[model samples]
Target chain A: MGPDSSQDAQTISQVGEFGLINRVTSGRAQSPGTLLGPGDDAAVLAAPDGRVVATTDVLVEQVHFRFDWSTPHQVGRKAVAVNLSDIAAMGAVPTGLLVGLGCSPDLPTTVVDELAAGMWEEAQRVGISVVGGDMVSATSLTISVTALGDLQGREPVTRSGARPGDVVAVAGRLGWSAAGLAVLGRGFRSPVAVVGAHRVPEPPYEAGPQAAVAGATSMVDTSDGLLADLGHIAAASGVAVDVRTELVEVPQRLTEVASALGADARHWVLTGGEDQALVATFPQGRPLPEGWRPIGAVVEGEGVTVDGDAYAGPSGWEHWR
Target chain B: MGPDSSQDAQTISQVGEFGLINRVTSGRAQSPGTLLGPGDDAAVLAAPDGRVVATTDVLVEQVHFRFDWSTPHQVGRKAVAVNLSDIAAMGAVPTGLLVGLGCSPDLPTTVVDELAAGMWEEAQRVGISVVGGDMVSATSLTISVTALGDLQGREPVTRSGARPGDVVAVAGRLGWSAAGLAVLGRGFRSPVAVVGAHRVPEPPYEAGPQAAVAGATSMVDTSDGLLADLGHIAAASGVAVDVRTELVEVPQRLTEVASALGADARHWVLTGGEDQALVATFPQGRPLPEGWRPIGAVVEGEGVTVDGDAYAGPSGWEHWR
Candidate 1:
């Protein structure tokens, strides 16, 4: 059987802890750099370039995702996606993952199996594997994923290197996830694409290392909305970023959905989070890399502005808020 | 101010998520392998030997730690300690950690700060840093820790490498945590040391690499009971392990506490877990390393036998059961 065929209807407690783990991990393929996989004291991954990029993210039920809105598979995929976005932001090639899952013991074992299946499916897309993990019983469902990546001996594209007069660009779509969230909230049957985006964001993973190769000075993943995340870059680089919203291309689907919901599509495009689009700053005359399109420019100042004006709407999603 | 002075009385929502993260991470020192610390999308670490060892563990309130029983500081320390023990079991030198915390929004923000302080304090003991993390709101308090380690060019001593003629030995205390658990269960105010073990286990960190240097054939940490964890080794190695109970020197303190609680000290020594002592198999003629004492030997068969008989007591902690 191919990877991810271990589907069982048994409850976690019925299968027992070890038995459930074995069922979830059965028939998985180990990717390159994973010298050792799960079932060991710890897994080993090769870091040939002598450095590894590491990041972690947590997703909580009701807080991050609701079972009614998304399947367990989608939740699992989203968990890996968010963590992978952080690794991508570092301009690194994703290598491996360690997943920590906390769930109610009474939950059907098939839920965990599906979660593991989705995780493996996503990791496989990036040519990586879930090398190690831990599982525990908890009152609420929670997923914690830590992603490891390799830089291949190149300098990491950090947020602090943006220079005045640099071109600010983006890869992939923005506002999709936020739009998806709205669609779900209003109980509207959004377009399949929009609903899927809300369930599992599609990050521009390859754009990160590609930007680094094309001499991008700074880079970040738009996790907490385009404006808010760019504000981070502007703050760190001691420069101002101006995004000409007109220059940002938004799909017709978003505008259509916004009109139907009596919301401004621009609001989602500017303030939406979890789209995971890669944003970078490059020297003004440098050739933009493939998959990247200029959205605005870096200027001499502080904070982020759209059309040279400070954004007045809600900035982004804050966990406490 | 020192590295861990972020204590405050404000609630998490009052401090705000980012503000609390800044407060908790303030003044911490970067360990040797840390190339980049927090505040970025991710962190970078040096893996000098071209490989990195990784492990993760999750601790949930009520399931793993009760607020009435463990101080938040102890809970935080225990989270890191358990993850570290896995790295140690792989005979690797820990270099960094990525922590994920989920807690009720109503929690006093100082609790998170104290938890972070405790994590930093424990990580400092082994000269590592909390490189990155994610925080979110949940119904229950949860801590997920992923530890990264360097093997330092030595072959990892996996549980499957033991031979029939190899000697079985361990470093660090056994049964103390189990005995301590009984004391706590009885509602008896035990000695500070005993109570401390149950709250925050002290693993013999140095002995992991020491065993590797001494050519340990197989290794594991006794996170599960001695028989259960060693059963893992036995099953993996396709050999039987024979433990001589007489050779196991249980401290008189454990016996005294066990009697006071109307429990069998030997039962705790044989079936209790979470002590995190390093157990390994070495060549029969090889001398036991300092801090390690021989307690058993690998025999020709599968499964573990205590004094040539199967253990009948509870095996160990099972997440489901």
Candidate 2:
């Protein structure tokens, strides 16, 4: 998938920029929105609703991912997964992706192949395609993914749409990624699910659209802890969000791993982030969508609270910190 | 525009991530296409044509820019300018931008403000807004820009449509940016126009749509040298392109700068890249569009030649090299 290996293993500089691009992108399928894919000045995507939802994120080496801790494939998958989660948060169907990769010239060409393969694998799962992107030489490996999605004529479910009395629910596992991170940090290999979760999060892709269709008042993806991201909703919607700790069902795998490590699992559930779970507030009395579990409710006020009290222990992950 | 002066002129680590985001994006006006801007899960933009054109580029510190040579403002502007040039090459009007920034937490908070200001200033010039983006701490500064454009019901001008009987034309200044780079390398800054050209290129943006309307068969931006970029057109279209050196008019300022530096002005004109000038091929017997000057012609065969001969020079920039 990379280059002729009969000769000596080639570095990226030996392969050249265009050569690497040709190798990585060859024979990949295009999605429905891709009118014109790679190998052009720009890519064209169908935005049938006269609107396109877009988001971008940059993951730097050592900061977002470590080569010592992850394979290039996992880095690629995580980059795409987090971006797709953003689209899912908007209640839009992901259609296309543009990736910008910066890496050292001395790096092996096979690493880039693995990265592309991982990105392609995850993108295929969500019914989207990598439309276009750029690659350049840098001191470190950095990934920038720009995700485009189609609204399908639905209003974007913004974080500002929640109101008092709306029911807050979550879809997908929480704290697994955080638990995985802890496991990796401690150099423990037990609890495969937890470790795998940190490597490649399985976000509830369908839950986002399902919530929107079920009339979710507001929505968000848990990238910065459940409470912290919900705090954004509260701040934006101008209402108080009360999360019920007892009602929250902690995943058994996380609990087992937490106990093994002599830590509280509830802390992970409450403050751990990057699980990409869909947290949404639905209109009162509306039945929860498939795969959703009720965890909280909106109240009349500002800021987020737990069981009507400000229960906080390390609010969230702040990049500057 | 920045943090309070009373508190040790704090770094990003002291100001925090959210504090920086709020300071940079607060109270900025949004364009019509920006249905939702920053501070959301994702931003939504109007496409209206059922199609959207997208492109992305990543500019790494030291590799793409040097802090010693340019201000944060110039770096930000160049990042936006280069990406917008790709959109223009597609014969589409840019509608929005999504920026992803990675920087060391030790950087001063004011540097980020200047960078955002420069980005906002440039985006406003193109009649769009910075719709969405992500920022995170890294070892060094890196900027990734994703530009979205609307074709407005026009067929995209791709590089693969040139016919044998076509006249090649170019709009906007050539060699000035290259000359400016040479001037900067020599630590001389007398030629404001040339130096400024390198710092902030004023691409013939309007020429893209005008050429499309005038029935340009194929179009490309000269991010690579004219010969190298034209080689792409030739390869894509499977047609030979010939340049008439005498027909290529060199601007007086470029010639003066080249003479002063004891350099071949034609070398800069032929092989210098990053001009972002729109180079296009139109059917023979058709008058060139406004602001476009005739330079060469398309012929039956493959590859690019100058004055009926293959001119020899370093073709263009190679990122991996």
Candidate 3:
């Protein structure tokens, strides 16, 4: 059943803002790092390294996701996952989250309950909690999540540190979400693997700090596709990246799905976004970290290329373009 | 002129997401505590006190403010001010901010420029910066601001620490925003004082730490009116608060405005909200902090009272009510 089909469901307006807040925050277990949780003007968190990594991502219904395509719980998980991935890309471990939710007053409180439950589930995976947040009435459903993390005394892995003769490696799935999106777009849900991947990404959260320990020169999450995000590193570091298709593995599952859809799996692997895979450049002589596979090389130039040739078509997604 | 009346103004879609992001972020100065700024996967801020205070607030167009009554610049300032006030209420000084903006594609880029300028102006006022943010397309203008702060080694003064013998005091203006809102609702904009107060609040940022230093036992910001916020302290601290009308000062300027509009100035002072004022409970013997004035007392009871009596009207604003 759809979220709004229940005629007797309690609307958020009926419960009121304070009531909803209490329902979402009450009786929740917080992590050790959460010094002070919800029910206050602000939340206090332990920053053991004396530094904090913070990032925010906003997801609007229809613009970023669809209620018809994904459940409120899945949407909630995706929202928190995307922001936490940004924190992970910084080579930090997440400490807490603050949510800013805007939804129509007619929205069912059950939707909010499921959404908060999904957020808490994702946060618990990283040993954190939704420490604080704000809720307000709006015309549409908008979720803004801010994920905070601790650096653990390591220097931040920014996009500007890549150098020549560095090997580019990636940890986590690539193009799987795009494959899932394609299946869903074709009105098919049987391939739940790709659809689930598209619904909630499994970002390589620990690989960020692991890469930092492995002396990664630069690191970024493939939220905007591999080549496009690599373009950021190239532009910031004044270097060129060339992805070798032979070294870049296009998973057999994606290939089969692409064959059925009459699409290019290679293109999906190189340009699909939202998978939240961690891509980093490291010195050429050392072994890549476990779970990381070599995919490309950094050269003393600019822009990204596949097999040293520019790939045709749009590189990645950009809003309002 | 209205924001959309400019025929030649470029729309946000024309600039595209990256172009707009670069336009808003380029050449912005960051605070000394910002270890890493925008143009990254995440921002790294120096949390020198080994702990961080975090809060999030969401403001939607029309729901929170109207362009017909206030400029986007004013809206931006109000958004940042409200969040920073939460940090201050925790007895922490703000270090940085992250913004999540969702606007329609047809929105004028000029509006974004002005909004960002106003946000920077307010951030600069507190010696901080907008370190990172996300921008996306939505049907309405939604702004979510996440503020991070440093406690400077002092314990956070939560709302649950008030005692029976505690004195209740306040710093900064009260009922001014509600007065302004009333004036605007009546279509009379001549009194710039109250109108501007409604447009932007002047939260006493330093007064929070000052109250902590002055031995404040419990504290809260008056975002939901003086009496209503005192009710929060009362409920959380398991104590009752009585506001002595004889001791509370209703400013003369508000009186003049109230008289002109045939309204009660004292009532506005008691129940109006959005002043961003700091309210706290302190021990009975010590002198109050500078800029703080005694207004009430906490005792062994429940709920809040106005001059030892129940208030006759609504205490404060609530969303979806």
What interface RMSD do all candidates show, one decimal each? 0.7, 0.8, 0.5
lDDT of 3 by residue, A10-38 (tens): 89999999999999999999999999999
Local error of candidate 2 at residue B97 (angstroms):
0.3
Off by over 4 Å in 1: A1-9, B1-8
Q: Number of the top candidate by DockQ?
A: 3
Cα lDDT tens digits, model 2, A1-321, are 444663237889988999999998989989866899998889999998899999998888998898877899988999999999999999988989999999999889889999999999999999888999999988878899999998888999999999999999999889998999999999876578888898888989888888889999899999999999999999999999999998899878788999989887888998899999999999999999999999999999998899999975887899988
Residue A118 deviation, candidate 2, in Å? Answer: 0.6
Q: What is the TM-score of chain A in candidate 3?
A: 0.97
TM-score of chain A of 1: 0.96
Point out where model 3 deviates above 4 Å. Answer: A1-8, B1-8
Model 1: per-residue lDDT, tens digit, B177-246? 9988888887865676788898899999989999999999999999998888999999999999999998
Enumerate residue pairs that collide in model 1. Answer: B240-B301
Candidate 1 lDDT tens digits, A183-289 = 99999756778889989999999999999999999999998999999999999999999999888988899999898899888899888999999999999999998
Worst 10 residues of 2 chain B by lDDT: B1-10
Worst 10 residues of 3 chain B by lDDT: B1-10
The regions of model 2 sitting more than 4 angstroms off are A1-8, B1-8
Among the numbered candidates, top lDDT falls to: 3
